[model samples]
Target: MPHVEKAVKDWQQQFAGLKTSAANLMQIAFPPLEIMQSPTGCCETRLHWQDQDSEASGYVCIDDFVQATLQFENVPHSVAGQALDEVFGLGWFNGAELGVRQAGEGVYYWTDETNAAEWEVSVLPGGLANLSIEYTNAPDIATLLDALHTAYEDPHEDDAAT
Candidate 1:
């Protein structure tokens, strides 16, 4: 009816849609299938995860958070350090209060998932980034580090499902 009302309605609908998506993902992740969505949302629409290739790491999850199988491989930790620095500086973590840690001389890690947008991600290390992040505290410190360590340890066996 009014401009302000229309904007509010639109925003509400968008939030509702996100909720529905989260519910759907929860159903798939923890219920009849227990499979997760790829960063691409490929298996999510089908209610099952596609067969994962060996590229880095693996993951297990619930609606709230994910647990990664940390075993990284074939990573140029030195190079990745710079790459990740650039990544963290771009998004919410850019000026956020959350802390980013250096796992080693060339490896970095951030345990904060506070600013992850639903269905937002560009790259996944150890399949640790969520495709649809609904909870601010998803993948707490230990779990995130596990995945990071795993992915870096055996980068070939990891997949993007977190």
Candidate 2:
């Protein structure tokens, strides 16, 4: 797994431009979202969902500079992960072992690596399984984001009735 962590640095390096760019990119990539800032200075988006049951969230942090984190949650760990394995052409993680890959930026995956077909899964409370991915920069990010946007924007039967 590839890892890079920067320790505390001078205040002068605090750059807002990069952080702003990351925030802007997120808006362009995601559907209608609710964003919030933490008292600790981290920027976070409330869990966004396509259907009422499934939920997801994303985050961006800036201290000395900008660091964007991309994550999606509540994906059906089995089917969804298999689909991604086929769509992205990579082995899936099952939320047990760690998997890492690189593209525009380094990405680390946490899931059960044992389940080849199950893919990256995080077993939530009550045995609900989910898939999550975190990355700073990646080539497939745009395509994946667009797909997610489409899913989120699609009109649902419940929404249409309302």
- Those runs of model 1 whose alpha carbons end farther than 4 Å from true positions after fitting are 32-110, 113-134, 137-162
Give the lDDT of residue 54 in candidate 2.
Answer: 56
- RMSD, every candidate, angstroms: 12.6, 11.4
lDDT of 2 by residue, 1-162 (tens): 122223223232344445555555655765453345455344432223344555544433322323334445554333333334334544343232222121111222433333221223344433223444443342234345555565345523241111
Query: Residue-wise lDDT of candidate 1 within 76-96, one digit each (tens)?
Result: 432233233334432333332
Q: List the lowest-lDDT window of 10 residues for candidate 2.
A: 97-106
Q: What is the TM-score of each candidate against the true structure?
A: 0.25, 0.45
Please count the clashing residue pairs in each candidate, in the order shown: 24, 10
Off by over 4 Å in 2: 1-14, 38-65, 76-87, 90-120, 123-129, 138-143, 153-162
Could you tell me how far off, in angstroms, the CA of residue 162 lies in candidate 1 after the best superposition? 27
Q: What is the C-alpha local distance difference test score of each model? A: 0.34, 0.39
